[model samples]
Target chain A: MSGKLLQVVREDGQVEKALEPRLSDAQLKELYKHMLQVRLVDERGMLLQRQGRLGFYISAEGQEAVHVGAGYALEPEDWYYPHYRDPGVGMMRGVTIQEMFHQLYGNRADATHGKQMPNHYSWKDRNVVSVSSPLSTQIPQAVGTAYAMKYRGQRHVAMASFGDGSTSEGDFHVGLNFAAVWKLPCIFLCNNNQWAISVPLSKQTASESIAIKALAYGMEGVRVDGNDVLAVYRASKEAVDRARRGEGPTLIEAVTYRMSSHSSSDDATRYTPKEELEAWKRKDPILRFERYLRNKGVWDQAWADQLREQTNAQVAQAIQLAESQPKPKLGSIVDDVFAERTPQLEEQLADLQRTHPEVE
Target chain B: MSRELTVVQAVTDALRTEMRGDDSIILLGEDVGLNGGVFRATDGLQKEFGEARVIDTPLAEAGIIGTAIGMSLYGLKAVPEIQFLDFIYPAFDQIVNELAKFRYRSGGQYAPNVTIRAPYGGGIKGGHYHSQSTEAYFAHTAGLKVVVPSNPYDTKGLLIASIRDPDPVMFLEPKRIYRAMKGEVPEEAYTVPIGKAAVAKEGDDVTVVAYGSMLHVALQAAMKAEEQGVSAEVLDLRTLVPLDEDTFLQSVKKTGRLVVVHEAQRTAGFGAELVALAAEKAIEHIEAPMLRVTGLDTPFPYALENQYLPDVPRVLDAIQRTVSY
Candidate 1:
């Protein structure tokens, strides 16, 4: 729009693209397949909610490339603090479609043990921390983890992702500022989807760009086309590498869009215009990446058809498994409050059991 | 084996002892290292444990708490000091949303194992920001455990317990007794069980319940009432959430009168919640009335803090009112 916006390759759907660092034909296929899987998962999730299967859900549509691209750019040991709408990232990090669906359906088989609502998943041993519904709170926590990594003299990095709306919170700035000053290995990935719930970017912030905000904190800031998986991968790779090397934190704002209702409970048509939706629809992350991969000779109709069929069947099997699992135990209300339940909690638990005698 | 020490000094001793025993236990806060913290609760921890364990963080509340979470996730026992309880607002989101929900959201996959330490309650000349008792904020969160110690012994024991706890604990140290209340603590490693209320002076006529700095005032009021031949059971609620309702209900049933006291504002203070809870549980108990002795339903006044606090006179006054009503 102004002063030659950064681009990896000119977009015409037929233009040849250059090879990226560390991304071979196989890896690109891996990234694209995951992106496509995320898109279909998002579609099925929405349909499932409409059919009264899920209570509510956050969509990961239209931003698959940003999540997968960025996720693929990191090491397994690096800490990942994901926000609510992070199924794409989770899918890329070896979380099964079954585990994700099981968690969404509140099945006891859910990895979270049915503790959180849909889209909030975490593996304590996976180095990827569980995310809550609150926005921007993890920024400082991630920074703190990075500080500890530096303190422990480990070559690990700590990274957190949040929306553009999160940058307005005080903790977001405090975390980044502390990381920059202390030279902690923290990576802040800002998914600038242009909206936080109903508030648009115009009302949520007055800054020129979220990336620019990092400049004031003495951190490297990169703005990338979120639909371009190559660019997102490269930018995140360099930033994460610098963080792993202890050069301090870096902020990368992935310019993207929310292609669906904010959640199952939201109706975005009230605030978003048709033209705006169409404009963002044209930049669908999966299609753009598919175009790039096709020009690279790694994509064909046969592969596309196979991936679609396999993914649909896998998702269906996951849904059936998720639906078949039993609900969590209601008696667990008093468990884990302490190493052992206190007398007071025990009394309450007894009262609850008496009131609902059918449980336990 | 026993010696007299201020509440602040006992806390410092407990931290030093705990840190020396475990290498994973770390302390981080502004001025906690070089300046020895605002009240010196962590006076010599930095020098004793080295900078790696006793970290001096930047002047950022969010930074302090959020970073402690990271340390906790990394299998380190983290204790974050909020120089003053009133200064904890900036970090409320992190504590309530992240630290509190770590275990619940992760389905018990990850426990925060963090303790947020802050000095609360009135008596010194700290106007609004430093003197207010803000324990209710932490109590409302579903997964967090809140603890407030009334004296030097409880401070040391509860702090040691909080450090070993598997969940996030918002540990409130009474500012009023930081230097005033003196007591003898065990010279060995021990921890007071949280969620258990201590019966300071057991009786059957009336139940006067309070915690943190207000325990001293409540005890003093109970003594005066004892001289009047109306025995008052002073129950110090060491922990707020998962409240010791067993002790509270038992005391209320035996006494037939309930009077809750605290330095927090009256409208929806922890005292009010306790009164309602007790009423709902043991409503058949024939008490004179359920009364609450608390600060006025206003922010801690800058100049009139003394009049605003629920002191011995005010607590005694409330006890009289509950009995007469």
Candidate 2:
């Protein structure tokens, strides 16, 4: 168990193996840019919350590479069930920055029309299912989708991502057991951010690692360095390939840290010590990826600074567009309850209109 | 063209007919395959449809619902049953949060054609765990349809309709009348439209609204009311959500009196919703204030089961109070 966890990049910017020669320069740059873009998004969201411009925000922060890497590993046809903190994955799966801001601002342009809180993003075109707030509920649903895929004889697999705290949920157990029993084409990617709200991972489970628990369900479990982008991508690619080939599900536990409070409403300083937070800050995923690119002679300080400025500008413009949009109309509140509105709902909508007088 | 069948037999007959008519329809639950279900509701389905269509799932209710949600999303009519309604609590989160909201949350992109069948209500002496009137819970949840059938004929038609419906449905079969009640059910498949009420008996003095096993008790009370020269209108509200407010409203408007009955607890029961609807829609027309005959606000008791359930006397008392008022 001690030696099984996989790591490709060390903290000192040393690679155990040469991946650059095989990975095209464009793909490498794209992966690096995605990680940086997600980081920029997270940081700006926190600032927006501080300024009272946004109602709520939950940043992926130090865990951007894991999400970006896993997102890059799947095909567009595959179904993805993401946790609430996977805005990075949402962006990769065809959710434009403008659309994400629409969700963040909960404007009329938002697909849910502010029905869900901010960070709840879903795109049906890319097969990204809407995410629920309940812990680990996506696990079994993902397995079910995978089972359906198998039943229909489709070659595509289904992937679900979650936090370490989600592993303790009953849905997680049910999902793993059902997937294994039926040999469904599914992947369970657990981003072990080490903290669920205020509770640490140690208190969450007595088991040494979340990955090892997969063995009890008769499935393969792999622990990867979540901070290392290449390692996460490689592991996810292999699991996705295996699933497409009808090899059933694999549970991949990405070992990383959460460098921010749980959400805008939380204060991590109360529970997480300053020293621990400071120590993890040095292992920041963005910093490590920048170093890795520099060592490979593919990046420099000038290019890095220019890229950050361009990405920040792009994010700022999206926020501006999102903020300028008008609020949702009151009539839409009664809409989408079902495919077709019941007469009772139509009457309720009429009542709201009658009372408001100004809304259409 | 029709044969007399009990409620439990009608359930199996509907499953067999539907599975034959539609290849996408399947059944999954604990012991539903080889054991023919606890109440033999799915008897011989595994043999007729094979194990793939009639799956025997693990004893995880959440998994059953979760997998069914997936199957439905994948374009199959997935009907999973809980052996008893009481065991469905573990899967409540999946049903309400995931299955119920799939169509709405996805902004109508996907509708989970999943039907969860459970046997509920108390007259069988199964104690607290086996007997519970939990329809109100599902009925209260938005984007979900709730149906309960008292007689075998309605049970078959409603179950068939639920299987074909493009949304998630909670089909609660009254366990008490599973065998006690029998009616002529059609041999061929047919659908009873959801969200519509059936007039069990037409009268003009008082409107008595009930469903599932309580409908039988309501009928008895109405017959006794007839002996005293009082005409009672008995309405069977098969579908609680998308409720047929028109049928009951018209009846209450004609009679100028209303009495709602159910075996669920008093507070926030389906009965409360009916009474509230009456007061909201036809308050001015009603001659007497509406009354509800419901089970006490207590967990179903083991020893005093008869006392716990709302009986004919309770319904009669409610009728007398409404008629005399």
DockQ values per model: 0.62, 0.62
Against the true structure, candidate 1 reaches a TM-score of: 0.94
Alpha-carbon deviation at A243 in model 1, angstroms: 1.2
Q: How high is the lDDT of residue B136 in model 1?
A: 87
Query: What residue pairs clash in candidate 2, if any at all?
Result: none
Lowest summed-lDDT stretch of 10 residues in model 1 chain B? Answer: B101-110
Winning candidate number (lDDT)? 2
Candidate 1: Cα lDDT at B324:
75
Find the 10 residues in a row with the least total lDDT in model 2 chain B. Answer: B102-111
**Candidate 2 residue spans exceeding 4 A from truth:** A1-3, A18-22, A300-306
